[model samples]
Target: MRTFEVPTRDQVSPEAQAIFDNLKKQVGMVPNLYATIGQSANALSSFLAFQGAQAKGTFNAKEREAVYLAVSQINGCDYCQAAHTALGKMNGFTEEETISLRKGESDNARLDAIVKLAQDITENRGRASEETVEAFFAQGFDNAALIDLIALVADKTLANYVHNLTQIAIDFPVAQPIEEPALV
Candidate 1:
């Protein structure tokens, strides 16, 4: 089997090295997945810029984290699941709440709508169920919010696909595996 090693500051391009320095300064450590992305000449910088722009969209930090959790879970991206689980907690979700979001459910009605919509979008490949879309709007999300949510899905999916393809080591606390139901 092939192995993907996380690139170090010294091994990456100067632009990526500079980004690594900034990430180390800002996030304390450059995550393995992000460092892996740094192996590419432009992906690290482009991803950061995309993420930064998405951060300014309609969803708040917590809401965005919820979307990430749901999308990551649906996509079965363990790296993203672990990373977003930690990020969800940082944005104020309790451990249980994060797990629930990963399962595509939430106690809060509005949040439930958001998480469900994220999961639906991911599972259906952009063709979210009309019912889920209706519920999202019923929770007071406008068209702008819908557009932002789609963008968030796209953003998270990019990272998820990268981690899925590379199988990099996770730098965050590992997320617990969700159990599957036994056959009847």
Candidate 2:
């Protein structure tokens, strides 16, 4: 199989180059995943907009990272697993806690609800069980929060599928392997 090389800034459209520059200025470097997405003329911008809009939602940084970790784990996206593990830690999740989140649980009941719902959504392809939806709301999430969760799942799903299809080189610290659950 051929490797998909991440395109350099100069190799992409000027609009993508600007996004790349902003990524470098903010994050210190263009991560391989972001650079790879920049290969599309507008995908990178759309992705950034979606990601940026998530912060305005009800979930905090920790909760959002939990969503990322849970979806990445369910999809078995090694690239995202590694990336979100580091991001999870930065957002106050311990390594052990991050692993637990990957397994669709958390010590905190509220967060566990979030992770469980995210896992269900991914595993069921958006047909999350009514109980799971109820549990999510019982954890203090409103309808708007649920919508944001779904949006986050959709955003992360795009990244998960991209990495799965491309088998992109992971730029984050290596995540330990876990057996992927069989798809239903």
Candidate 3:
């Protein structure tokens, strides 16, 4: 099995080093997963641009975090699960709510619809069921919101796949695993 190391500011290209400095300034510390991405000459910056562009979308911070949590959970990316759990809390989701979102359910009906659709889209490889799509629309999401949601899923999935492949150390508090309900 191959092992991947998280690159330091000194170990990466000048562009990635600048990104590391900016991330450190903004986030306090460079996350291990971001550091790993920094190993590439431009991946860190490209990812930052892609991630930053989400703010222009219809989903607010909380909704975006919800999608991220659900998608990360579905993708089994421990790193993103931890990261987004913290981010979700910052975006006003209680810890329990974050857990629920990760489980592809939520106490908020609209948020539940969002997570369910996100999970379905991820698990079904972008082919969400008509029922799920209707439920999402029923929750007041328009076609633009749907497009934004899909973009959010794709963005989150990129980090998920990177962390899954690299198995980097998580920088945030580790998220508790969701227990599966027993079969009746």
Off by over 4 Å in 2: 179-184
Q: Write the per-residue lDDT of candidate 3 for residues 1-45, one digit (tens) a residue.
A: 698888878899998888889888997999898899899858778
Off by over 4 Å in 3: 181-184
Which 10-residue window in model 1 sums to the lowest lDDT?
175-184
Worst 10-residue lDDT window, candidate 3: 175-184
- The true-versus-predicted C-alpha distance at residue 58 of model 1, in Å, is 0.7
115-149: candidate 1 lDDT, tens digit per residue? 89888888888998899999999988899999999
Quote the lDDT for 55 in model 1. 89
Residue 9, model 1, lDDT:
90
**Superposed model 1: Cα runs more than 4 Å off:** 181-184
Which run of 10 residues does model 2 get worst, by summed lDDT? 175-184
Superposed Cα deviation of residue 121, candidate 2 (Å): 0.7
Q: What's each prediction's TM-score? A: 0.95, 0.95, 0.95
Clashes of 1: 0
